[model samples]
Target: MRLLLVEDDPMIGEAVLELLRGERYAVDWVRDGDMADTALRSTAYDLVLLDLGLPRRDGLDVLRALRARRDRTPVLIATARDAVAQRVQGLDAGADDYVLKPYALDELLARIRALLRRAAGRAEPVYEHQGVSIDTVTREVRVHGQPVVLSAREWAVLEALLARPGRVLSRAQLEDKLYAWKDGISSNAVEVYIHGLRKKLGNELIQNVRGVGYLVPPA
Candidate 1:
């Protein structure tokens, strides 16, 4: 999953970024609300971990602006204000979930998972198709009841494919998900990862269209 963490505190921001990245999430963090707004408007993220106390625009204004633009990306508010009214205000302003500051990392991860599930219109983190199962929360995959170990990049490639089964995904699209905007991507990196997944999951699992990109055939 990809996340945009909007936080200004260096200590908290670095901690959250490292923790989430360790959990296999591609995270882009911004210290101010202007950068957050730009990222929200420019990128496609699975979720946003927004800190309510922000520099420049404040988190409430950020949430309000996001809703005003009709951007439906799920947001989990992270704030030091633990009052009931404050939580209500965040939710009312369009936050999908709330996590008070000084929170447990596990709880924050849980909220992120919950919000992502809600965004995907699912109630669970496990994704199943064609006898292959992907545990989004665990970052595990199984095929034909056997565990399949994949490199981080390979796993990322497969998850992107599974996210939209039967729909052809261009190499550029896959690259976008695998890397941040500033990261350099090899032209054949997608092919390399696709080849790796095909070898692991069976060649029939993913199909290559001559002119289009790749697709995971519907079960």
Candidate 2:
């Protein structure tokens, strides 16, 4: 999934970015709230990891602006503020989840997964359609009970499709999800990954809607 990480602390930001990228998420990191706001407004992200204390503009204001524009992208607030009132305010400001600083990485990852699943309207960690299963927690894929290995790019495409089963996603949309802002993507990258996924999973798993794009049909 594509994510925007709004943080100013160098150590924390780098750590979080590395961890998320290790999980195969396309992440764009920004240090200031103004950049975060601009990125949130211009790009489509599956989730946002926002820090309340920011430069130029506060993260809460950025989130409020996002909601004001009817952009309901899920946001998880990560800040040093541990007070009950601060947590409540963050939620009231539209944060889907909150993680106080000095948190366990595992807990933060779990929260991120939860938020992503909730945003996709799924309550389960494992996504199963037909005979194929994807374990969001383990980042594993199985076809008919047999484990299948896929490249990082291929996995990104599959995750995007599975996130919204039966919903068509254009090539452009898939591309956006597969690449970070600074990453270079080839013109045929999405097609290549799609073809590779079909080979590893099965042709019938993902369907091309001709002019529309691709989707994983409900089983």
**Top of the candidates by TM-score:** 2
> Could you give me the TM-score of model 1 versus the true structure?
0.93
- Candidate 1: the clashing residue pairs are none
Number of backbone collisions per candidate:
0, 0
Name the lDDT of candidate 2: 0.93
All candidates' lDDT scores?
0.86, 0.93
lDDT of 2 by residue, 26-68 (tens): 9999999999988987899999999999999998999999999
Clash count for candidate 1 is 0
- Model 1 misplacement above 4 A: none
Every candidate's CA RMSD: 1.6, 0.8
